[model samples]
Target: MNHQEVGKYWNENAQTWTTLARAGYDVYRDHLNTPAFFEILPDIQGLKGLDIGCGEGHNTRLLAQKGAFITAIDISEVFIQQAKETETQHPLHIHYQITSAAELPFAENTFDFATAFMSLMDIPETGKVLSEACRVLKKSGFLQFSIAHPCFDTPHRKNLRNAQGKTYAIEVGDYFTNQNGDISEWGFSNLPESMHNLPKFRIPRFTRTLSEWLNIIIQAGFVIEQLHEPRPSNEVVKQYPSLQDSQVIAYFLHIRCRKS
Candidate 1:
């Protein structure tokens, strides 16, 4: 139930996760999360960036595409290997390493920016990870990351649906409970019926209150710049009906902070 164990779970999930995610099974990410994260992001052309928890280098490749020199890391060896394989084929010049976010291999002020797509909340040592992110960012550099909304996506959550099987509200509980390293099992909801038999991913849950996240970011030497609760646009909802539940409540949170 520690970070090492969490890494092992991710290692087990690496191949399937990468395959499904690349195949568009991660609907929320492709439809809402990643697009929202990029909307507020500053131009990183010619900058040196570090992507912590860069599973299979999906978002890292996006960063590289924006003209940044990227070094991406993930604790899972398989994840890094898959990312490296992608790099070999595409020749993006990205550096992929098997490294924990809580213990980065780089020196202080080494990167102009840093990012953790949806991986921070999965990390058991959130504070240490943020501290390491701060340590590696240059002065005025920013760290922009996204996570499941703490208020709605608690240790216990379910979608309340109407008679037509449309989600109307979210039922969430155990918000005050400490959930460090608790195991949660679920597969991507967007997978085709033929792939319904795929094994569920065993992911470690590390739930924290919104205040706790803010305090940790401040304690890590970051000044809060922007906080966003991303909801799918009308067009997105029409395209991906499953995301309509997000209109009832924010499903994801994005934060951008500057090294102070």
Candidate 2:
């Protein structure tokens, strides 16, 4: 898969994401690791917040409910459309804008908190995006970005093994990401018997190792304050013993850092 072709895939799968997330949130909470209120919500309050790649405006609407004036931006107009529809149904006043995470349209020091929930890896130009995130965050402001853990969330590493050897396996060729970015395979799951439940396809995902993820923020002049590796809850523990002490430590990291 062409690494560059993935973000567009998100545009295509925009509506399905909401459906998938809604389904996961309700039925399969065990497979999900979404932290309550965007990981760093507790650290900052009553300040301007930016939600980059605000798909379906799920987290954006959450931040608004918590009293942060938010600017929600995304690259896909289709996603924006779906997000606005969701907003109308939910009725939250999050300012939605169609924009790319790589090149934010806002001025410097424009926000107090910048968060991209599970979306940074989907954007193509993360360096520019992070720089823009830094540019807009106020001094002492926070940036909390989360992504699928690079080590384990990877498709290659994501699988199931039984006594028969391999019961279920999907493509896992794309893993390491360099300065240029990594193109990874992705797909969607349709509700049974519904062809339009979602389109299944491949796309690219970008991320750095935990060290690289941390160092970039430091070089960008932010001080790491708290690092969160959310362990699976008891339900997960009781359900999947195979995930015990695996090569992957955390499925996601909630980094709270300040631009100091």
Candidate 3:
């Protein structure tokens, strides 16, 4: 499938996704990935930033709260509408638009920085998305993104648990197999049991190897700055026991790169 087809899935999922995400059902993002991504982020006070695949603008609002003027975009119209509704009530310095990450609607050197929160892996054209990000960033501008770890969160993954029912290791295969827009159906594991009847999300999967991601970034004129595998803190794990599995094997990867 192409980006448009992938976007249709997201659009269909927008309302449920926005509702659950806002209700804090996305535990990995809330307690692990976003925290780690922001920890390594450079200060963005007074900077102009673009949020690629901003979803309901949760992370975009975080950036804006940190004093950046943010332009946030997503391919799903309903997602953008939800984001705009929040912006209207909260009044952050955010501009919301329904736009595709692979084709940014801006001139070259238009932003000081850009960010994608657990979004890069959802989009079909990774290379084109990176190229657009690089093109729109000013000299020395950086782009940060997070995704399911290509090494561990493969098309085939299984968890090996100890006698205590705690994850001790992860079993993964198909590391070399690349997938483009394969449909994956699942619901947020952290959601309350009361929501068990909720329909699962149909997300398009776009998988690439670690080396392939690095090469794509390099080809898009980006110099690798840092790569992070986020592990939940002991305190966080205590609060969210399900996240303890992250300590055994990283479930997510964060990358920061500068336009060369």
Candidate 4:
């Protein structure tokens, strides 16, 4: 799919996605992605930052709380509207815009840092996003992003469970295939009562191998600083019993890269 196609798909699902973000229904993000991101995130006080694919401004708000001035952008107009609505309720020095990450409508060297939380995989032109990120960042500025782990979260991944309903092995296929399409399942069936009747939403993901991901960053003029595969902590697993399954396989990968 092309960028416009990808944007069209997200725009179609914008309402459901905004509802999920507002209701805090992202189990994987709350339990896994956020913690892993913070582990490597540097102090951003007084820094100007860019947040790409900032759906509903959830993470942008968090960044504001950490004392960073934020310019958040997304491809879906509805998503930008929803994010602005949330900003009205809880003011967080953020500027929300509707724009594509591939062609960032920003001046070069304008940001100290950039972040994309679980968004890069959904972007069709991964290389363009990386290049735009590199261009917009100031000299030596850093970019941090998280994605569905390329090594383990393949298109044909399945869980092998025992007769007692316990997961034993994680089976994966076509790990090297670079492709895009609808994902199996991604909605919160356990949302609050207000959202119980909400429509089920299927995510469209673009898959890439680990080497491809690295090469994209490197080719975009970034030096890889760190790579992280995050899983649930012991306490988190206890709180959310379903997270116990995460130990069997990594769900997300976090990468920190600096402009070279």
Worst 10 residues of 1 by lDDT: 176-185
Candidate 3: tens digits of C-alpha lDDT, residues 178-219: 877778899999877989999999998888999998999999
Q: TM per model?
A: 0.98, 0.78, 0.98, 0.93
Candidate 3 contains a number of clashing pairs equal to: 0
Error of 2 at 140 (Å): 0.6
Q: Candidate 1: which stretches are off by over 4 Å?
A: none
Give lDDT tens digits, candidate 4, residues 105-202.
99999999999998888988899999999999999999999988898888788888889866677899999886676554556745768766666675
* Superposition error at 142 for model 1 (Å): 0.7
Ranked by lDDT from best down, the candidates are: 3, 1, 4, 2
Model 2 C-alpha lDDT per residue in residues 1-260, reported as the tens digit of each score: 33235557777767666667666422222243454324445644577899988877866877787788888998777778888887788776678998777778989889988888778776655566777888888888888877766655653554555576432433343556442344444443324465453455444555566677777778877888877666655567466543343322555656777788
**Candidate 4 weakest ten by summed lDDT:** 181-190
What is the Cα-based lDDT of residue 178 in candidate 2? Answer: 41
Task: Judge candidate 1 at residue 186 and give its lDDT.
Answer: 92
lDDT of 1 by residue, 124-186 (tens): 888889999999999999999999888987877888999998888889999988698878899
Clashes of each: 0, 3, 0, 0
Q: Each candidate's root-mean-square deviation in Å?
A: 0.9, 4.5, 0.9, 2.0
Candidate 2 or 1, higher lDDT:
1
Pairs with backbone N, CA or C atoms under 3 Å apart (clashes), candidate 1 = none
